[model samples]
Target: MVQRRYSGRMDERFEIFLACAPGLETTLVGEAKAAGFGPLRPDAGGVAFDGGWPDVWRANLVLRGAARVLARIGGFPAVHLAQLDKRARKFPWGEVLRPDQGVRVEAISRKSRIYHGGAARERVERAISETLGAPVSDDGVRLLVRIEENLVSFSVDTSGEPLHRRGHKEEVGKAPMRETLAAMFLRECGYTGEEPVIDPMCGSGTFVLEAAEIAMGLLPGRTRRFDFERLASFDAAAWEAMKRGAARRETGLLFRGYDRDAGAVRMAGANAQRAGVDGTAVFACQPVSALERPEGEPGLVIVNPPWGARIGKPGPLHALHRSLGDVLKERFRGWRVGLVTPEAGLARATGLPFLPPGPPVAHGSLKIRLYRTNPL
Candidate 1:
């Protein structure tokens, strides 16, 4: 059975999936709730909510922890390739895709009768191409097909580029932390934008810049284009009005980032300027040993130091972590701390009074955990 609900306006209600790193689903759900998006349900890799196209647009524009937004168009049971072809051709592709535009089909199969992903993709591709008269290209809107228990569901990736791009920060350091992960980690540390943030190892200034933007109430996708704009249901005028209506807040607190490499310091500064947050984000070249507590109400210190796998041998990294622990204990009294690392041993090596570790989050190929400390 196909379920449908019309919103009685230009926008129709549909299911939206906000994709995130695996362990961050709960945090993303909190963000969604704070953004006034619900009723929400948490899933394995993302959060699911029911909304119209406008909700989809708002989610893509404002969600800081989501990697992408997927709109679930519709689905049906199809036990075989031929049935999938028939059902896919009958789908209302014209409702979302323009005839002149191109689309790419991707398929995943799990415990299904039609278990071949390639065959499933090919059939769906042919159906859409023949029925909708649209060209299939590699760089166009992506349509994802999932087959499980003989049921096929279709979703469109409405976010063209990953939300982490944020349409700024052209220059990045080696092994830089993603903006999405950085935002979630900040949230995990109980940061609410009222307090300042410091990143002693601020690689591309992701954490500092993200914290500054949060304080300013800036939309993450304010300057970026999304794949949803290419869909047939996109309303340019409404989107423009929505963008103009964003309420930006003003803040006086400063976020700080320091790196031992002068080049990294310069890069972070430049990236902050491009992000329109240089006023609130200060970058300097210094090692953790020289880290000084900024003058303010005590705030949070968040850092994503290099794991031994990326930067150096484990022995040196342990020494570095110990040194960092010493610096924070000695200087940053009453400040909270969040440290991200791939190894628990390295985290333990820090000797900071971290509360129990959080679940590991997948970043690239490594599983990293955030170890946090209360005010010290």
Candidate 2:
């Protein structure tokens, strides 16, 4: 499903799908429900809902846990490529894209007779190009066509760049967590911006920054320009008004981050500044053992320590985990703890009372599991 991030006097209703990290569907659905959405059902890495263009715009702008927002264009039975072509030709491509704007088509076929994906794409491209006089290309205004079990569906991408690039992080450290992943991890930990949040191993300050932004009620897409602006019905005035509304809301302080590496600490500071959350977030350069719990009542402490794959050998890293757990138990008994790691054995060595670990979230080849502990 391609993201539909447009606004205007067109259709008031659409089928919107939210893409999320695996094992986080329940979390995302909960978020949507809390945000006054749903009757949502669980699906692979996403939650589907019915809404209009306003909801679509709002989702991309405010959703902290979604990877992307796809709008369903149309779907139909396609026994062969010709059927796909006919259905695609009848679609309202002209409403979304201008004749001067170039379009790209991508197709995938499975469990059906229409196996030639390249040929299917070509047919779709020709249909739109010849019928609507819209030019076709390998780039720009991507229209993703998915064919499975002899069924064909079409959608236009409304999010030009992936939602992860929130235009905030100018400098990122090695193995830095993406902003979306950071937000999702924080949500999984039941963060609601009321208490002080700490990230002891905050490489590049992603987790800390996301927490700060959430506390402030800042729209994640405010600082960045979206591809939706280029669509046919984009209401610049409304979008600007929405941006102003978000900016007018003052952001609060409920977040801090610490990294033992001075270089990472400095990078985190720079990223925070770029993200406009520097004033609300505090970054400290100190070892995990020396890092003190936030000076308040019981809050939340989330960490992303360097596993053996990114920075060090398993022996030293295991010792680090043990030291972290020891410090948490000794100094911060009332605080909840959430840990993100690639190794379950090492996570267990932390000695935290985490339940069954979460399913793996794909970060390239490295699948990570999130483990959490109760606030004792």
TM-score of each: 0.97, 0.92
Question: Candidate 1: deviation at residue 72, Å?
Answer: 0.5
> Per-residue alpha-carbon lDDT of model 1 for 1-376, expressed as tens digits?
6733333355578899999999999999999999999999999999999988999999999999999999998888888998988888888888888788899999999999999999999999999999999899998899999999988988999998899999788889888899999999999999999999999999889999999999999889999999999998899999999999998889989999999999998999999898899879999999999999878799999999889888878989999999999999999999999999989999999899999999989999999999999999
lDDT of 2 by residue, 118-237 (tens): 999999889889998878776667788888888787766677778888988878888888888888888888888777788988888988988888887777888886656666656788
- List the candidate 2 regions with Cα displacement exceeding 4 Å: 1-11, 247-254
Error of 1 at 169 (Å): 1.8
Could you say which candidate leads in lDDT? 1
What TM-score does candidate 1 reach?
A: 0.97
Give the clashing pairs for model 2: 3-158
The runs of at least 3 residues in candidate 1 whose Cα sits more than 4 Å from the true structure, single-residue gaps closed, are 3-9
